[model samples]
Target: MAAGAPRIFVSHLSGIAVFDPAGDQVGRVRDLVVMLRVGQRPPRLLGLVVELATRRRIFLPMTRVTAIQSGQVITTGVLNVRRFEQRPTERLVFGELLDRRVTLTETGEEVSVLDLSVHQLPARREWEIDRVFVRKGRKGSAFRRAKGEALTVEWTAVTGFSLEEQGQGAESLLATFEQLRPADLANVLHHLSPKRRAEVAAALDDDRLADVLEELPEDDQIEILGKLKEERAADVLEAMDPDDAADLLGELPTDDQERLLRLMQPGDAADMRRLMSYEDRTAGGLMTTEPIVLRPDATVADALARVRNADLSPALAAQVYVCRPPDETPTGKYLGTVHFQRLLREPPPSLVSSILDSDLQPLDPEAELPAIAGFFATYDMVAAPVVDEAGSLLGAVTVDDVLDHMLPEDWRETEFHLDEEVATDGS
Candidate 1:
């Protein structure tokens, strides 16, 4: 935490904010780019990936960065709006090289690179990888006795991975994050470059990928979906909730939408088509066709089980609809809904119909956005069923979906800064 510390851990630099020379905030350092050099020499710093408050990322050359500290970075106040695209000669330190294996020059022992530090060299504008932190005896070496302490090595003492992606591919990246929840993985993807994002998306399973796509910003969602092969995109679309899939498809050109729909499961495609037929602002467009459905006589226990589906969001899972025979959604008749709170209060054996909130009227598929919002606010409900004239259930709109539509279209791309204050010498 010294003034413009010359040596620092890469992890500490990962999320630090970047500010302009005027002391006004710009954005945070999403990642550092370096140009890989010939064999045995450490790569030199090339630029920074700056993530703005709007969730959009831009590239800033190292020449534009004036200072670095534990919590903040200083920029020359020049920002390039062009997105970060990797040149063949460059590499990302944390994203591609961190946690990689390297051979120590002193002991000739293998170790995992734990962190690294870059320093401003002779020229005021030039920086180089001068130090490295490696976890010794990563598996079975005698240094394992150090008990989790990492050895700080100068960059010259170890060998670096040569691949642009650090000798790893999409599969390796996916395996590294397989344990993370879809939402967590989605968050990581949002901060990565488009190529890296596409690599990870290509490696995720259809269902897991579907979950993550739903959490991404609309533009990112479309881009990732576009990266998938048509067949696989169709599969992922099928795996996604009808409402999310519909919204994503609706964003594409009509022909592209038709092409993707053609490859989806007939049933899913039909549901998506029906949802898309309604105006994007209508209840039908915001609703998922596959809400938990209960036969009028289904027990409270059954209702609980239906909502327990892992794929359902909290709002979507908060209630179960009661319909006549053939209780699958889009059912015979929309009897009413049984809120989870009602189910828990009643005995496990109580029929869903026994606690149905018949007073909470359903919305018409064509109900406008404001009317739908009003229904949710007035009823204090997280979800409401949509029904047709025949009184048959069409779908259910969750509060989350309504909010997604309500927020400004560009809300996701705005840049923001943390409220914490950072003292700098303005070097």
Candidate 2:
């Protein structure tokens, strides 16, 4: 759903068929998962518990969902088959919330929940329960419909659903830090005891956990990964950036690495193996296999659309790689680069190949850390493409990855504090 989409009542979504991009039904939504926040803030609609044809229930993340229409939910077709497990922080809308009695904040009168309405935030993928459909006088039973006034109220107009501000446990801790960036959240997780860290990690969604794991130290990453079930660990690894996932796998024992790789999707496993084949500090190892790749004839409009992806890092989005036939990594003969600034200046319909910066030399797959860093410094580039001896576009290395390798091993452990006075003056 886009900005200003009409709010959908949870009752309407019940038992809705879930379809893939191909329009084939994959499953039906059994329930919605939400994480309650501290205080009366609306709970975030995390994802859905989808029941497949085999009677197997799995988690379908909202990130993978493309649209929720009248009777069906359309997904990006990337479904993780692992069984859904409710964490300490997750609440099931169907099983826990509906038909429950809660108080109205305005009149202090108790109301029975009939249904809840959720809306996707404008310009964002996140959805939240924003309204409540309730009965005023009495709770309705399965066999009896009590005579009572029925009405809808804003989510904030009710109480008793959200977590308490002074609540303890990982649920409260997670709620408190829900808005923190992955790096800042990783820092917080780093300071926690191993048990607390594991609890918090388990409470986080796979995509979120993957982002935080990429920012954490190697030891922490290994420890947290070890604590999760093998299936879940594999899912989280698949969610991580290819290079980062490969780097983490490289730290594990050979047998453990092989086990996780076997559990991942074939395409992801292949990318991991390819990345792992490279020397740790080389261009191939540092590069992400999923950089935006466009064919020679792609237009400026196409390039801009790819760059606008919310999942892409600013460094990776700084430019796009133009290649031949195959658009994926290990693409057909590398053409050249098209910087973001150049894309913006060109007419939307203009061919990207026409404005390609072919003069800038791309890095060789075996280029070492020092040489790769030198290329970035000399070219003043945030990212540089990597090509194999055959001239196939392998992947692209961003300046951030270069810095990650150049920094001391214990650099992540160092605590940096900003002085309030200095920050005030600077601002």
**Top candidate when judged by lDDT against the true structure:** 2
TM-score, prediction 1: 0.69
Cα RMSD, model 1: 7.6
Candidate 2 regions with alpha-carbon error over 4 angstroms: 1-169, 416-427
lDDT per residue, candidate 2, 77-183, as tens digits?
77777656789898877555765578999899987777889999988999999999887886443234556798999999999765332211243345435566797
Q: Which ten residues in a row have the lowest lDDT in candidate 2?
A: 418-427
Instruction: Enumerate residue pairs that collide in model 1.
Output: 52-415, 53-414, 53-415, 53-416, 54-412, 54-413, 54-414, 54-415
Residue 382 shift from truth in candidate 1, angstroms: 1.0
